[model samples]
Target: MSGTALQQVELVVRTIAQTAVDNEKYFGDLDAVVGDGDFGYSLARGFEKVLEGWDDIDRTDVGAFLKKIGMIVTSRIGGTSGPIWGTAFMKAGISAGPANELSGEQVVAMLRAATDGIKARGQSDVGDKTLLDALVPMTDAIERELASGADHAAVLAVAATTARTAAEATSELVARRGRASYTGERSRGSVDAGAMGVAVIVERISHAWTTEGAS
Candidate 1:
């Protein structure tokens, strides 16, 4: 039952798409508490397009699929999330290229590119109470795991745990950037909406990748 990397990527896409759809209301609710209530809907629409365009996406190579997905997200989705997320995926796609299969090192490289891209686009650091709060540490953990010669699943596991921890830690920090910044003290004790979404995607993708590798 072992699936290829492409299969893993596809499963991740589908799982993220499903999660975005199911939790759209939750994100909107979170956003409404502090910022604009658009993150959930915007993410849902972006991932929905990814799912609906799967037929065309399936025919493309991995890098091409990722690139197309990024473009689709940027063009179809609204709000700051669209550009930031699109930049992350596009950077990953560039790093991944059109390889038929990716080594663990390549996976690590892609993750690093994604993190750097998010930082570059958002100009925020790990404590910004944004998605970077999850992504930055996760990518660092992933690189460390891979450098230790861990398997892809192992690296992903480390990344997932790091992301979850970072996402949770966002609750304690004041929002230093984005719409949440205006809330100041009010933003404390609540997870950033975008960071929560990143955690969800990271956890799901880690589970899928590990299960696929084991199978």
Candidate 2:
């Protein structure tokens, strides 16, 4: 039997939490090169809170669950990442509404809404060496592949690859926003830590949904 929508969301959350925990040191090392090095700890702490409160999350409504995640992260995490990531999740949740299940189109819309929320919160655009560098491209890839009638696994594969590539490419660009921007040309040659984190999260979430959890 297929997984329920609540189960799918739980899988995604678990994947994200695990990814953050697994890559904590790596993300901190990345941030040390271009910005303050607290990103890893902050993200991990926030996701840890989400895990601790998982049982309390309202599973009947996917949107409510996602919004609860946003609030948990925002309240627990520190720095700009808290607000940015929180806003992204909140916006996606809003786009999801109260639906028990989401279609591919609804998923795409959620991604788009999340991307827009990030932009609005960060005031940054693509190629700015921020998370948007990876997220925007991933969203676009998902939209394109879904439009082409790709299956869930196929679309997620393409999206994950695109996000990874985009994150890697940030090493070639100068930072235009955030603490990294203060480094000017020195920010080049170092991948944006936030972008890499976003890539990891997206890839894991996609894998969880397409493989272990739901369509």
Candidate 3:
């Protein structure tokens, strides 16, 4: 891979951080309906810490950098959101496996690992109206696009769209996990905050990569 392509990992991190900052309040509002209303704040603080410690991370190794992100998030953010997001990043890092750069296939693998990690950590499934509602669909879309010989940018775009659609659909389902589950039928009309967060991150990632690739 070219040096330019390798730098895309850094771009992904920056994009996610910015997305978290921009949508923090939105996430909080979503959670306030069915959860503790701190989901957005926790995500924002965690990503901000990732940015703050960016200089200390081993940027040359994408896996190590992602692992650092997971560690930082776990340390900075309190509550269940911290461990869930941290586990996702850490599992993605493990899938990345010390690579300095990632291919389209590797990116898919990383996303799958992250989704699996969230499922394991939260003990939630796709119909549970958790982040997996968005993440699993996004990952599946990426895998399909890649299998069809789409490039990284194309795959990411499809995945982002899928995540958004899945997130929107969450409003129709009753929560089966997380604090939202405590609300039972009351949670049916509201979208999952974590799912919305996943949608935002994937959308930002798609936009960032597409813009960078074009440039």
Candidate 4:
């Protein structure tokens, strides 16, 4: 079970990295609507570092692997992207502790930890028109699905859809955080790039899970 869990984690993380790298231009375009247009580039660079050091990351446990990735991201990436994303991973790692196996509840706990960390690091929350707007609702959907006895596949599916809907809804919100917030009311009518990035990454993870993680 622990070995399978590790494999699943690796698959999910790898998918996230690939999605960030592949959609760099799309993400940048989204951010350019009201931001400095560096969100995608910054994210890609951080995840690229994760991929580059994948083989070298300490896998003593899930916590170590996630924490190591967090450190790499924090150190390698620049601007706001580094701190926001890195804090998420680090907090999740803290919740995961030294466990090699993660139960469904543990996964939720890790996600909550990550979300809280992001809120703290960015000083934002749901309705802030930040990634938290999408992330919070997606996490809620995931928790509800899991509580109903859904499996990973079901949770991933729900989360992906929820994230997309939530991200798209951000177009109606005025940005309250990040560089987009600097534009004030002008930030309306544009989706939050980080939220959309989460949607894309979760969608890819869901697809990858269905195709390659049924074991």
**Candidate 1: segments with Cα more than 4 A from true spot:** 210-215
lDDT score of residue 59 within candidate 1: 34
* Model 4 C-alpha lDDT per residue in residues 4-77, reported as the tens digit of each score: 66677788789989899899899999999999999989988889989988898998888888888789888887
RMSD per model, one decimal: 2.1, 1.7, 1.8, 1.4
Give the clashing residue pairs of candidate 2, or none.
none
Model 2 per-residue lDDT tens digits across residues 110-204: 88898899899999889889999999999899989989998777887898889999999999999999999999999999999999998888888
At residue 23, give the lDDT of candidate 3: 90
Task: Residues 1-215, candidate 1: write the lDDT tens digits.
Answer: 15777777667667777788778999889777778789899988888888788777743667887777788888778888889889887888888888768887887788788878888888987888898888778878877887898776777778788888888888898898888899888989989988888788778788776565564
Rank list by lDDT: 4, 2, 3, 1
Candidate 3 local lDDT, 38-125, one digit each (tens): 9889888888888777777876678877887888877888799889889888899889977875777898899889988988899888
Poorly placed runs, candidate 4 (over 4 Å): 1-3
The best-first sequence of candidates by TM-score reads 4, 2, 3, 1
Local accuracy by lDDT, each model = 0.81, 0.86, 0.85, 0.89
Which 10 successive residues of model 2 have the least lDDT summed? 206-215
Clashing pairs in 3: none
The predicted structure with the larger lDDT, 3 or 4, is: 4
The true-versus-predicted C-alpha distance at residue 83 of model 2, in Å, is 0.5
Which 10 consecutive positions of candidate 3 have the poorest summed lDDT? 1-10
**Where is the poorest 10-residue window by lDDT in model 1?**
206-215
- Backbone clashes in each candidate structure, one number apiece? 1, 0, 0, 0
